[model samples]
Target: MPRAWTLRSRPNGMPTADNFELRDAPVPRLEDGQVHVRNRWLSVDPYMRGRMNDVKSYVPPFQVGEPLEGGAVGEVVDSRAEGFAAGDLVLHMAGWRDEAVLPATALNKLPQLGVEPQAFLGNLGLTGGTAYFGLLDAAQARQGDIVFVSAAAGAVGSAVVQIAKAKGMTVIGSAGGPAKCDFVRSLGADAVIDYKAGPLVKSLAEAAPKGIDVYFDNVGGDHLDAALAHARKDARFAICGMIEGYNAAEPMCFRYIMRVIAMRIMLKGFIYTDYLPRMGEFFADMGALVASGQVKSRDTVVGGLENTPDAFLGLFTGANTGKMLVKL
Candidate 1:
């Protein structure tokens, strides 16, 4: 038997440590075409917060009384599938449980990249992949461009900065604290702005007087508006995550949306799963970047399976600098 966290209630505002409960259960068994995986690492991300409430969104909300679900890395402990065997590491949409029985289709065999295995949950996985595609394929950044990113110390945000920098762009990032700003600078950002200290619009103007060519938005609300005001002609905006307004009761104001019409800005919101077909190419490019030391992957490990909920809640409060993962 192993313990797992289950949703106790849909959160009304910011989640408390009590919105979830930890309980024990028997390890699941594999049926035909199914493989039983012993989870080793679990991801805790800001996107999961949107799925906690029973609201219409990009993905379905987490059902009440069900074990919370998200991305995880695990090893096959038993298999009823033909191609998989015990000890093979894989990635799946398995949630907060210690173990799971999933159809082989949901599992992707992880490559032995010789980096930390957890990088499969961070840089080598969807986080890095999202930054790669969203910026290159979607935003289409070019040489000598000015790029700005929000939530810039996070796993995905950090990757966006490095990718833009490597492509010869001047990258400016906005984070919450001086520590996170320093981390962003260390990642090769040309300028770092601490949004918590003063007005974001003024800071962006001072840092990027020529104006921004790409806006990789992770924190929305005021951050989004400020970036739009400073966007250069034909700028591209990738609306990734909106941590600033995740817990808000009403939608954040977008008074500057008129600028999109006037400026002809290409504004788009994306969910990484929608670009599944391009994942092969995306992963290959990011792999080479990591191999050549052009991009770096990082994780903040939260120990103990029982503490998973706290780790997930930390995403909203900026408690993590990179990917937040739980080690069992």
Candidate 2:
């Protein structure tokens, strides 16, 4: 018998382990054009927190008593699909389960990137895709631009820092602690702000006295307000995630939102799926960066399927440096 995590209940505020239940599930027989996979790695991301709520968003909300889903990399155990075979590694969204029986169309064959298969779930997958598209396409970051990134030690933020640096942009990153600030600095940030130390807006103002040309927002609320205040005229803002307010009981009010008009800031929210058509471009660019050691892959891996809920909960606690994963 295989085990999978189910959404026991909708979280009131911050999610707890009690909201998830691990139950034994039967692996369905492989039908035509279907394959059975034994997941090797499961991804736990901040965006999944939004999915837990019963809301109308880009993706549907997770249903109660049903298995939660996210990215997973696994080896094929049995296949009735034409293009796939036993022992082929694949990536899919049937995670939170030890084994998955899904259609071939749902699985993407992992490319031989000279890296571990788990890399597909981090630097070479959605994590990388989000950062790449968000920074380049959405934010339109250019060489010599001053870019400010929030949650700079997290998966997407770290990538944003590195990508901006690689493109010759001056980057300032904001993280929660000394260690995370150090990590962000190591990723080539011109300056790193310890948001936990003092007021975020004050720290950002001090770091960029001339105002920022672009803002890559991962943590919303105060971070967003800080970016709005310090934005240069006609600055571009790529709105990625708002992990700070994800579990909040009430909406966060922005005091500097009025500056959006005065500064002529372009704030845009985006989903990675919208850039799926350019996935080949992402792979070619990011793969080369990773291979050349320009863009590094960092992850915090929790062992076992049972701890998946803990890994997911850890996102809000800054328990992960980069991408968080569960080794199944």
Candidate 3:
């Protein structure tokens, strides 16, 4: 039997432990194409705040009384599939469950790449991949270009800062506090903006005396508007997750609609799943960076499956410094 966190109630604004109920159940049997896995680590991200709402999203909403699932790293305990074998380390989307039965297609074999396995859920997984494709493909950053990123101390933002620096771009980052600001600077960001200091527009203006050529937006709301104001002509804005407005009763409207057209910024909103096709290329490049020490990966890990709810809810309050995960 495995214990899992199931949805107890839909969250109103911010989710608490009350919204989740932990229950135990027998390990499921593997179907024809499925593999049984015992999860080692589970990830909790801010974008999941939107999934709590009973609204339509790129991914389906979490149903009441069902287990809440997300990215997880685990080991194959039983396999009914060809490519996988028992004891093989794998990464897949299995959520908060201590054990899961998933189709082989949803699982990827983890390389013995010397880095921490949690990096698969952060740096080399969806977070890092999102930053890689979003900045390079969507934002089209060029050498010497100036770039600004919101949620700059976070998993994905940290990856963006390093990738931009590696590409010879001047990167500026906006984070909530001085600690995170310094963290981004440590990741090679040319400038760091403390968004909690004052009006983001003013802070960004001071940080970026020259207009920014690319804006990788993760925390939307006023941050998006501020980036729009300081953008250069024909700048590219890769609109990723909007953690800021995820808990609000209503989604925040972008006040810089006119600026998008006026500045000729090519703004594109994307879900990380859209980049699944390029995961191979992402894994190859990002894996090389990790192996070579160009990119740094960090995880704030909580021990025990019982603490999964706290880890999930902590994302809303920016409690964790980097990627938030629970070790089962």
**In TM-score terms, which candidate is top?**
2
Q: In model 3, which regions exceed 4 Å deviation?
A: 253-255
TM-scores for candidates 1 onward, in order: 0.97, 0.99, 0.96
Report each candidate's C-alpha RMSD, comma-separated, in the order given.
1.2, 0.8, 1.4
Model 2 agreement with the true structure over 120-207: per-residue lDDT tens digits: 8888899989999999999999999999999989988999999999999999999988999999988889999999899988999899
What lDDT would each prediction earn against the true structure? 0.88, 0.93, 0.88
Q: List the residue pairs that clash in candidate 1.
A: none
Model 1 bad stretches (over 4 Å):
none
Number of backbone-clashing residue pairs for each candidate, in the order shown: 0, 0, 2
Better of 1 and 2 by TM-score: 2
Q: How far does residue 125 in candidate 2 sit from its true spot (Å)?
A: 0.7
lDDT of 1: 0.88
Q: Tell me the RMSD of model 1 versus the true structure.
A: 1.2
Clashes of 3: 2
Provide the global lDDT of candidate 2 against the true structure.
Answer: 0.93
Query: Can you rank all candidates by TM-score, best first?
Result: 2, 1, 3
